[model samples]
Target chain A: MKMLFKGTEAIAEAAIRAGCRLYFGYPITPQSELTEYMSRRLPEVNGTFLQAESEVATVNMMYGASCTGRRVMTSTSSPGFSLMMEGISYMAGAQLPAVFVNVVRGGPGLGDIQPAQSDYFQATKGGGHGDYRMIVLAPHTIQEAVDLMNLAFDLADKYRMLVTILADGMLGQMMEPVEFHEMRDLRDMPQKEWALTGASDHKPRKVTSFDIDPYELEKMNLRYQATYKKVEENEVRYEEINTKDADIIVAAYGTMARIVKTTIRMAKEEGIKVGLFRPITLWPFPYKRLNELADTVKNVLTVEMSYGQMLEDVKLGVNGKANTPFYGRSAGVVPTPTEVLEAIKKIMVGDLNGR
Target chain B: MVDKAVDKVIARMPKSLSGKEFTYCPGCHHGIVHRLIAEVIDELGIAGKTLLVAPVGCSVFAYEFFDLDGTVAAHGRAPAVATGMKRALPDRIVFTYQGDGDLASIGTAEIVHAANRGENITTIFINNAVYGMTGGQMAPTTLLGQKTTTTPYGRTVKANGYPIRMSEMLSTLEGSAYIERVMVTTPQNTIKAKRAIKKAFETQIKGLGFSMVEVLSTCPTNWGMTPIEASKWLEENMTKQFPLGVYVDKTKGGN
Candidate 1:
């Protein structure tokens, strides 16, 4: 059954359904509703909810809870997310599973509470102090955000890495009908022998990001690289619409893709033959599919709520095979459908280049 | 050689210890404290259900020293980590071993907030007045008029600031169930320190509240003194600045 739910609350409910009982977070705009929801709802299900001292403590708390082999998650905005970068890096290195929801707000330095995709580079390019990648899922709608929380948790545990739900402020605050799957049984979760349960059943178990010996650390890095490679191979997800017969395929994600879809219809009426390709997984970006599209399509246009962060991946996919043009707005600006159509029209007229 | 006829085991290591040789400096009290905690866990028979959260200072490798399941948290984040562990597994006993710099300085916010919430966890705070792991750097618990790497000319009220008394400060917070300050300079004091640590854990086991024991430790390597001198200096100078005793006792007050 579909229920009318606010975006943030739906994400919280969906996480509870996904067997995530331990949530540690602090309030931030556009995402505070999620934390508030967990605070009220978690206790009904015998879950743990804690408002940590700061985002630094919040992420570290999640890290600690995750070590006990329980599902954990948190939500924050841009500045708070930045504070969590250090802990996120540690979580990634320690091979812990956790989910983070960044209801992205204007950034660079507390620009505003308005929606923006400014944290794309920070999310995809390892914002913290090491070589790590968080499987970033960009959900365009509230229902999708609800659904991706399950994927976020599953992928996090499966890969023993971080998975982030990269939603902008618009999607976080927007209301929509959301449907949840059956509740997951935490008891059904496979036992992680490596977790620090106790020494009674076996020898002492240890988990840490610390491998002081250079050679031992290198070996751990090699193992991490293997997991990342496996993720890249099997977990690429995207949605392509009207792309088979289109002359131009616009690459966008998150809420921006919703606008691009409208632009696609407008361009269709104008005989532009524009298509839409929305990446569901932003980190394991649908690069190979875009490469194939470049072979058949003449122009590839990229639209974003930020200043062309994901465009780099689009460029990497095409690799000089086709003309890549970009149109982006930042600093809390969401480009309209008409503006996207205009960008598509310019790409068709050969007046734009992917710079 | 098994000398069952002539020898009898009097003082032996606790089963909760990992049997690994400690890497702490000579005369360092971390070794003594580690044994004290292990003894408490052994006595309580909670080794199978106890989890240790090691800090990022000299005890960063403390997870390896304990037979209990454990992990290492970043510098000054042990309180938060312990908070997570205890909240997730309330049946499992959770504790953190932290240094003066880890608990009093960088992690002050984490420790205060965790205690303020009354998390059911234990913290073993080693206040050696210097950053032991980082090569004798000045710490927030460094006594005034004492010299160190950061406060080369000696700690002063104006230049550096007054040393933090964590036990007294945290005892005031309603969340804390038991808070105590002790030292392990001599045999008598070591026994008293063990009592304090055991009481702290007992507080957690009783589901009382947050518990901690601030141990006044010696840093002979950093203080430019011999092991024996460091112990004597702790008794003479450190004891005057930071007194030893129970600061809070919720168990006795029916709290």
Candidate 2:
């Protein structure tokens, strides 16, 4: 049942297979196909599909549905995702398990419908209030979009944490071949010990973020910090290409990463020993891998759709060990391979000048 | 047959829920409304099967009062939360309790759309003419020429706004399966209010569609009077603007 589909549809199909029985969301550009696909498919399987009146309502619905131990999800673009911040904070605070997909578009606010990676800071820094972090997976291709969604659900259930699939609008709109997996057996899935299912004689399970006691809230914060420590230690994932003995490395993610892969190949043809480091999980940020690459690579050139947001992390990873330069294209434009190759040449010249 | 069902439901009220004590100021209708819902949940034997989504305003702390699985929603978003709860667990009885300012002002879109979508859920809306929690601010339901904090000069169509007849507005929508406006200001009306609540829940049980019972409530604190004065006020001025009695009853018609 392999078929060519848009990245958004691939994610939706993967979610349907992951026992995601409830979906509450609003339609937004670059990701509307995902909701449209769910509306057409969910009812056939007796799954819940609700087009919420607004993004704010949709996310709150996700909150309530998630509270009931159902595999719930919602998808939207940058602007819509912003409107969902309050509910996202609630989900994070309650330590609820839910999956959220952000097909990012340009903006600080309603910038444009075109593809953009400007939401990198918002996604990585926890888009909502209070002290919390969401497990963020960055998918470069359509196949990864499908694959990551299943993994997102599992990890969300396992950690009782919010999981996010962060992809740009271009990746969402582009068509690519995606592999499908066996449908997860809902009965075989683990039962949520914390969800509000019934009010029988057993101990009542309260699903809430409110803690009037300072000590209890403090303990919750420490637990979250400890959890993030474990995620940083065990959950960091990335891809390496031509870094075996390469002199220069180009770090990117999502569409920019794919473009960097092609640019590295072009650079190699031109007798420039360039490599690529594509971070798959942007939240755990793959700092250790970047540190390892810094030991061998003389220069690291970071590229993205937004103007140098992730480059800051690359700099921290390099930690003054190498000369790291950033190149960015903004306002609905993706950087082409030629542009990245040109940036690589500039970085190489800068590297030679330092010698 | 109706009497039997009501008696069975009345028997299941949890002891944890105070059988009589209430913090709602005297003549305030919230105590009556909450009691009716708790009684109905008990009567239907759905106390354990129901998830009560509570709204902000006076009922913000309803989680403390209701013995059922309760979730607190932000202002005006209780219906959205209840919609999510209902869709996620089709077997559970999910309902939202909201006040006029919460439902009509901030949450109007959510309530209207949830009903229009015919979501399998119920809404218990309490319409008190003045905003009680925020100190007697003029609410969406504040009648013309009514005076309050912001409308000290009286709610004027020329200066302030007209009262919103929410139940009637919602009854006109095709998505409304059972829409009723009841008053809890008197015992006779209290019986009608309970019947409406029971009918709304039954509609959810049948999986018919969206059902709502808008209860005309009282706010003595905001009305510059005692609980008795507020109840009398509700019977007098508020009823003239909001009105009572069932706007639409489709329970027998089966949606």
Candidate 3:
């Protein structure tokens, strides 16, 4: 049905329609709407929805429900997501598949419940432990919020990877039009060989990563690294605009990326050739694609809702091929499209003019 | 007929066990509790289908001894991990083997709420009144007047404090279906411990609710005593502080 839904609600609805049977979560600001949405909708489809005592409990519940091969999910914000780190680490170690939605807020420690991209490092750099990686999707708008959540579940199950849907408070709180889908049946899905549901007489199944020998653990970590490489090779995803002949390129993600889209359009109108590269998958990051763009663009300016977190990746992608600069706003202040356009103008002409 | 019954009862244990002898110190009650859990798994014939969650204590390497599907959890977080395991495979038998330090100290919240929610799982709690895994240290169950490395000059009532009665504490919750406190001081008590373990498993099989069996175990190495002396101490001092017998058994009231 066509209806205006908040980004958090849309993501929750998309998860519900993706045959998700269990939703465990603790309420937090900028994302409580998602839990509220699930609380109302999950029961209608005979699904389980639990408001866990805390974020820690919610994630563990997600771990438990996911073990049964049920499509399970949890939603929380920055501080809540921090509490869930231990569970996330266990999920990765167990090779369990589940979706986690982090509606990002400013934080070193509960900085504010407002929108922030400060979790860039935590999400993309293996937030928990034990040499593991999770599939992280950065959604820029309400539509992408719904779309990425479904894709998150799909990637999680297919790769036995923990998938994270990361959006900041802006997208989570903003309302936009979205079309919902009827839930799909998981019965026809490929059988999960690693799950401990039950061992038939045919063969016994086991799920663990407790080998104590250093060499064995090294080999297990090597396998995980190889799988991460494959994901990086096969799953690098992004959106590009006006890159055919551009001197300056702007890189951003999530809420900032969406704002940069409009900024790029305005930059083009001003006769200063600037393009936009918005990464969709923050982990298995679109480095190769950005590297290719770096060869063509004169300078790359990375913008974000936090202080220059993603700029480091932009520089890594460019690798001295292009001049990389950053503009950011932290502590709950979201930069406008005009602010980004102005920053681009200053970078193009303010210093090292036309270099 | 007596020989036949005896033969059936004295059968060999399951092959799913890791076969490595346990690393627990002599006079430690972990071995007795482990044997009891193994016997219960044997009797139920669910060892093949059971997924055991081991805690980080002296028994962290329990996965090495139990011949079944087992995973080791972070200290005190075994219940949290078991919660996931049980939810994932509701049909499979899932149980967490944890210690007093691992459960009552850092993981108290997870265990309490999981029980309060009536999660259909089994928790085998080994209360040794001290932390045996990490040198001799005072545990939440460490009795007043009991001394350890962390509690010098004995655990004072006003200072180091009284021992926690987990079985009594957990039995007060409405969602808990079966809560029993058993002692493994002798072979006769060991048999009763096995029965408690079996009942906790049966509760899950019947989809009753949360079940826990807290075993009063000895830690002779940590207590600076021989294995026999530790068992004797458990009989004299430990039993008086943490009494044996079921604190709460609600299987008849359960589904």
The DockQ values of the predictions, listed in order, are 0.85, 0.49, 0.49
Q: Show model 1 residue runs off by greater than 4 Å.
A: A351-355, B1-6
lDDT for each residue of candidate 2 in B1-255, tens digit (9 for 90 to 100): 666656455444454354434557777788878888877777788877788787888887676687767677877888888888887888998889999999999999989988888888999999988788888999999988878999998988887658888898888888888888888877888988998999999988988888999988888778788877777878888888877777776777634
Candidate 2 residue spans exceeding 4 A from truth: A201-204, A211-223, A295-298, A353-355, B1-27
| CAPRI-style docking class of model 3 based on DockQ | medium
Off by over 4 Å in 3: A202-204, A350-355, B1-10, B14-18
Error of 3 at A335 (Å): 0.2
Best TM-score among the predictions, by candidate number: 1
Q: Tell me the whole-model lDDT of each prediction, alpha carbons only.
A: 0.91, 0.85, 0.82
Docking class of 1: high
Q: Tens-digit lDDT track for model 1 on A134-224?
A: 8999998888898899889999989998999999999988899888988999898757788877788988899998888999999888888
For candidate 3, write residues B1-255 as lDDT tens digits: 566656456555455555678788867888767777877787788866787778888988886687766667766777766776676566788888889998988789889988998988999998888988889899999988888999988998888567888888888898889998888887888888888889999989988889999988888888999989888888888788877877777788624
lDDT by residue for model 3 over A15-92, one digit each (tens)?
987878788889899899999998999889887777777887777767666666777889899999888888888878
> In candidate 2, what are the lDDT values of residues A1-355, reduced to their tens digit?
7799888998999999998979988989989999999999999878989888899899889988988988999999999989988888878887888999999988877799999999988888877889999999999999888888999998898888899898988889989877888888889777887777657644445666666579998998888788888888888899989888886888999988988888878887888878889999998898888998899977888899999889989998889888888899988988899988887787788665665
Worst 10 residues of 2 chain B by lDDT: B11-20
By TM-score, rank the candidates, best first: 1, 3, 2
For candidate 2, give the lDDT of residue A152. 94
Error of 2 at A258 (Å): 0.5
Q: Return the candidate ranking by lDDT, descending.
A: 1, 2, 3
- What is the TM-score of candidate 2? 0.92
